[model samples]
Target: MQIQSGFLVFLVFYTLITLVLLHAVYRTSQLIVDEEFHLRQGEHFCRGRFHVWDPKITTFPGLYLISASLLGPFKACSVYALRLTSAIASIVNAYFIFIIRRTVVGKQEDARVLLESISLAILPPLYFFSHLYYTDVLSVTMVLMMIYFSLKEKHNYGALLAFFAIMMRQTNIVWVGYILGWRALDLAMKLCLPNENHQYRLRDLLTTVQTLLGSRFMFVRVIKLIFSSYYGYILNILAFMAFLYWNGSIVVGDKSAHVAAIHLPQIFYFTLFFATFSGSELLTLLPRVLRLVRNRWYITAFGMALFAWIVQQNTIVHPYLLADNRHYTFYVWNRFFGRWWFARYLPVPIYYGIVVSLAFLLFAQHNGRPPLIVSSLVWIVATVASVALQQLIEVRYFILPFLVLRLVQPNVRPSRKLVAFEVAFNLTVNVVTFYIFFTKEFYWSDYREPQRLIW
Candidate 1:
């Protein structure tokens, strides 16, 4: 009864918010370049440019096709129409969030799961993007659906949704691959180990490989199992390659400018965001953390200062404040480290060391490693590593993985104080960010002229 009531309330609340966002975003005069470009591509597709490719475009045709299908019927190219799609996608995403919560926390804790769904629905990062017409919401919605089906033990449906997600955003291949990889790992472990109680070790691996190879039939069976489990991933990879080939380049947009490169600080940035988002949950563990850091407060302080200094030196400048080099990104990269290669790249090793150490500690704290828990950790680490390999550093890139990780997290049964804090913090941040989106201007600085926008 409580679950039903909470769901009803959330439905009404989310619907009202979506309607307001759709109305406001459609009427706004200001346009972000990313959305504008996507809109144009949609228009072009509607006008029979299906076979044509644009080198300037940085993504697949999934979103363009979606928008064209919606707008072409009415002969509308309005920003509102694009955002209407996003609004609808977001609602569907909320439903998936609810289902995911129920799956992770079980039906017995209906109220808790409902609250978790609300937290997901109100997540500021996703909320901000849902107001725009970009593929972010649509893609994330598809990804979430994939996760839902996977958790329900429906791999066929998950694979289908994953294919669609890849179409929505090519980068989704990494996410889909992560899921499939975990499944493959789980299957391999099951096949190689004689019993569920077997502990995996170097010697055990050697013995298993030798035993399997000694029997040709068993080796053949192992090969068959491997292929059968991962056929979907193989198909997706082939599709991705075909799309890239048809697009006439392995990557879209400015490849030289945005080629794959290791940026170790990405893990740090995303981990910090996740920690902040659930700061209340983490506060419970603060005593232990503090105890670990006791007598090392000065070292911790120095490390934070060093991190701040490094950020100051390598911040990517935002276009709106380019003229004034006082902005955080500008101050860090331009004023401090732009001219010195040594200073610019000096933090890479330190970040790697810290992130790796923390990740191992996190895994160690889990005690018994169930397949589900181990797979989840692997997925999180792989997702973070994927972003770390990217040339660009965008907060949006981290949003889906963060949400997914949170969704799969164990039920904490947070105290009333913690729940209240989370609710208040989410509400405050959402309201402030929403107001800023409508009232303020930020700029995309990659172009020669730079474009004015709000995000």
Candidate 2:
């Protein structure tokens, strides 16, 4: 009966998310310029053609390759086809979440599942991402896969999954490389020596490096290279693309390269990176944030999110603040925070962030798990580190790490009474947010548009 109830709740939450995302994809189909590109790619990719050079004459072959690969049965890239792809990715993502919650947290967490339910169900930023169409949907799903499979001790499969994710979108190149390479080396060492913790010997490391740079081994070699030297992988991508453009088959437009290249003062960069990227040096903030969660954390988090939103307006013009492609999390938070001005005045993003943080911090403080010690620290530092990029919010970066605390940390299940209380309080927040967002403009319209306008 208990299992049945949990499964039922999960399905209900899943159903709600599906419905909301469908609405979002349909609504979003009309808004974003990127969606049009994705839609066109879905349409064009079905024909088995690859574009290397011209968007007018050729498209970005990468994402389209993904779409085409999925086109085994679909006829063309209509709204249904593109959205279907998005839907499939969402289901896969949700399934990954279910898997994590079930295995990582559920099995052991008699009390922890309460926290999981609250975090998964009511976290506004993550919830918002579910309804939208962006590379993040896929990137995050792959990230969960990487984490889950790696933890499950399926190193090769996990590495392969991480590889696929990086291929789909380049954002994870650094994180995935670090994670997969470390694990692979660890495993190789274990395999090489039956005892005494030996693997990936000195010679193995040299050979692996040679194999990647030399490309003698090909697929495996490239994988090793991607992990060994990620920047080089990105450069190889740019060089190959440049090669096509040089040969005249493709025309790469825009001053994005120029834009990304124009340097800001290192002082400003340092400040931005420091504030955004949390390191061991910054663990001081965690306790502060945790303390805030005891009472005023939601209000403080909301205010900070608003500030991030406000600053992000300038982030666009000065890519130094945020890369053009990044910063959606802040943007979304700004939007959700702005919803306070909607028909009834609500703070969807802020309210959720606050409550979620409260639950997470309080649970960690109360439970006191040993294994979670390092994971929690890593997540905190990384989440803070995420802000340094400044261009796009890409909420998944922080949210993913934030989520680890709930999953890996110990769970002393709150009482049925407390769980019921949290569930109710959180549901109220969600209800209010849905009402506000349904009636209002995009999430960050209030803070963002004004900033964008004033600047």
lDDT of each: 0.68, 0.47
TM-score of 1: 0.79
Off by over 4 Å in 1: 46-54, 74-76, 197-219, 241-250, 295-373, 441-455
Can you write out model 2's per-residue Cα lDDT over 184-289, one digit (the tens) per residue? Answer: 4444334333353332234555554454456545536455544553343244335545665675532234324222221212112233223232222123234555
Indicate which candidate wins on lDDT. 1
lDDT by residue for model 1 over 280-359, one digit each (tens)?
55665555555545656776666666666656544453343344431233445565456575574565444533443344
TM-scores for all predictions: 0.79, 0.56
Superposed on all Cα atoms, the candidates' RMSDs to the truth, in angstroms, are 5.2, 10.8
- Judge candidate 1 against the unseen true structure and give its global Cα lDDT, from 0 to 1: 0.68
Best-performing candidate as measured by TM-score: 1
